[model samples]
Target: MGELKLMKGNEAVAEAAIRVGTDAYFGYPITPQSEIIEYLMAEKPHERTGMVVLQAESEVAAINMVYGAAGAGKKVMTSSSSPGISLKQEGISYMAGAELPCVLVNVVRGGPGLGTIQPSQADYFQSVKGGGHGDYKMIVLAPASVQEMYDFVETSYDLAFQYRTPVLILTDGVIGQMMEKVEVSEQKPRWTDEEIAKNTPWATFGKKKDRERNIITSLDLDSARMEQHNHHLMRKYEEIKEKEVRFEKINCEDADYLLVAYGSSARISQKAIDLCAEKGIKVGLLRPITLFPFPEKEINEMADKVKGILSVEMNAGQMVEDILLAVKGKVPVEHFGRMGGIIHSPQEVVEALEQKIIGG
Candidate 1:
């Protein structure tokens, strides 16, 4: 359907950004994700498609730049690792409250601090449960492979502008750095001023002589108005939960045991399922593609079919709690993980399932 290339996950993200008719990108370099910026700079999308790629002074500055550009109704984005993402939280909250649409890619590394440049899924709680201080949620997409890392950029932007909210492409160091064959879409021209004006009537772009000027701000000193705004946000979230929940089911039809995971964990669990099959164990995998609008309903359904659910993650049992609530105690929901940037193997996952869910 598109041009194919062997590219690293981070490079796919950068290339996809250019192809998606993106107006601008502002980001700072962090390991595991630095390739995104590097590829963009080397490619010089401005020369090819009038795309602007600027390395910001800091992650905070980059996110604010995205806010400013997105306000102008331009397709904009930024990428960073975990700690850098933390620095951008306030801006992310501002973007969310203002209802500005933009794509943010977080190639997760380790920890509460600078944990490690190696892969880790420790940011699950931060990503899905509102990392910034507010009653705000980003549409979080957990991409498992380099192809998904490439493909989700366009999907994130589509969701962002459709809902007029920020969207996140959340992956980890392994996916960001891993190389794979990806089919990239052909580059499209950037949106013209007239096109932007027509498509995004709410955008704070140059107000036409006939139309009323758009006012964009998240600040409301009036408690009543703020509460009303919160209500509106909640309504939007409910609609998204109904409409945008995405997931993948592997060998779930007749599985006796299930593995619930996402991102790299999901990929590992797929192999673990094969290992389980070889052992005459019927293990299935339920991968949540959209972490925010999680596939809770589907998981609840799976609970009725499977004997137990093993929440495989790279954190300290973060997503396990969500699975627990989804199952509603209908069956066993246990967690297996390795923190501090240590990746777990398929054998390890199989062992955890045998001991924790079945043997326990």
Candidate 2:
């Protein structure tokens, strides 16, 4: 077993990046997630592991830096909260379009515009569905625990490089700020230049005499070529959907009702499940680990078994639409949320389940 240490979720994420040999981190400071860059700056990963850590002038610049670094075939990453993430949407879209590999962490907070530093899942649509303008998809991983926060960093890098696309770690402030015991993996050495060249031939490194110069751009002037590119992207998404769906089912063996949630909401919903159990209600929890390649198969199968499903979140019902699509109206699925940075307690979630799903 790896060494266990008590750490905050944000700290765990930063340390995990170091353990995974992330080549660079370019991010702007934002509340609820600033710990990521702060830890990197304090730890001086450049001195420890030769990893570059830079605080860019703005979120826009930070993401563009990530795009540039990732284009050079490096394992790059960045972190931000809701509003800051919004500012990086254009750069994120560019990364997705160019099929650059990088990891983005959204320690989500309340928002439409500068909402709150408190936790919220309001960015579900923006994170899972295309955030910026274009027909592109990012691999989204929602970590429910501090342990997952540590573990998913490595997973995100692997998936990003495997698919040649950006991967998002969708978490919230509650998890980011909370402290928990985490077992971290062994430190990995950074990829050598030879390894990078061998693994990422498409990367825009200095062109050698043997091969043509690599071009990383989303632009396609020819209409027919653009259509072809779109088709290619769709095929990639299909492959990701087919192979990468991940979710966790808890107490679902003979459950009568189900709670659908992810990240911090999933943690709270687990408590809600226990609360419902005390009242003789067998409530199961289906927590999606991968939001983009959603666990639709598991959700659909559970929808057939459970009498009702309660989609719990910290927003005004965003992921509920995905649940609805999965269930296909086979069973009743209702959304229960507390918006504007408000977090719902376990008791409140139980009440909502009874009022919105079970009784009503």
Candidate 3:
């Protein structure tokens, strides 16, 4: 077993990054997630693993720093809450367009503009859809517990490098601030310069004598070349969708209704499912772990059996659209949520299912 410790989700992410041999982290502090940077600073991982942790002047600067380090084949990460994440979108799009690998953590807060410090799942559209200009998609992982926060840093980096694409850890402030026991992983050594060169031949780690110079940029002036690149990216995305869709199902085989959710909402929905069983409703749950590569195939299969589907979220009906698409109207799809940092309760979810799907 791994070493265990009680920690907040944000702190777990920081510790996990250090344990996973992350080369560098550049980020600006923000509410509900400042603990990420705070933990790193307090731990002083520079001395421990030679991991560089810098609090940049702003969120924009921090994301660009990630772009620079990732371009050179280093394991880099950055974290911010909702507003701060908005600042980093262009950089994220740039990294995606350049086909660079990096891990990004968004511990989401409620917001259209500085709405609240409380948790939210409102960033669903932004994380999975291309938030910035151009056609792009980020591999989004939603962690429901502190243990997942600790575990997903390495997982995000692994997927990032494996596909040469940016990956997002899309959690919220509830998990970010909540304390729980985590089985921390053993520390891994950072990659050497030689190892980096050998593993990432496409990286611009200075001009190598054995290969052609690699230039890292998203800009392609020629229309034909840009179109070709877009097609290539689409193919990669299709491959990811086929191979990486991840979800968890509970009591699904005998469900009369289904609850679709992710992140903190998934945790709540689990309890809701239990409540439903006690009421003899026989509801099941489908919680997406990878929000981008959604478990569409599973959802589609369930459509034929379930009477209805309810998307329980912290935002106004963002993920329900995807559920609707997946079901293709075979079952009624409805959304139940509380907005502006308000977390809906298990009872509320049960009521919503009864009213919106079961009766409506």
Using lDDT as the measure, the top candidate is 2
Pairs of residues clashing in candidate 2 = none
What are the RMSDs of all candidates, in order? 0.8, 0.6, 0.7
**Model 1: per-residue Cα lDDT over 1-360, one tens digit each:** 887899999999999999989999999999889999999999989998999999999999999999999988999999999999999999999999999999999999988798888899998988888899899998999999999998899999999999999999999988888899999888878899989988788888777799999988999999999999999999999999999999999999899999999999999999999999998999889999999998999999999999999999999999999999899999989999999999999999999999999998
Q: Write the per-residue lDDT of candidate 3 for residues 1-360, one digit (tens) a residue.
A: 998899999999999999999999999999999999999999999999999999999999999999999999999999999999999999999999999999999999888999899989999999998888899999999998999999889999999999999999999988999999999989999999988988888888889687789999999999999999999999999999999988999999999999999999999999999999999999999999999999998999999999999999999889999999999989889999999999999999999999999999
The regions of model 1 sitting more than 4 angstroms off are none
> lDDT of candidate 1?
0.94
lDDT of each: 0.94, 0.95, 0.94
lDDT of 3 at 113: 96
Pick out the ten consecutive residues of candidate 1 with the lowest summed lDDT: 199-208
- Candidate 1 C-alpha error for residue 80, in Å: 0.2
With a 3 Å backbone cut-off (N, CA, C), the pairs that clash in candidate 1 are none
Superposition error at 81 for model 3 (Å): 0.6
lDDT of 2 at 78: 98
lDDT of 2 by residue, 59-162 (tens): 99999999999999999999999999999999999998999999999999998898888999999999989999999999999999999999999999999999
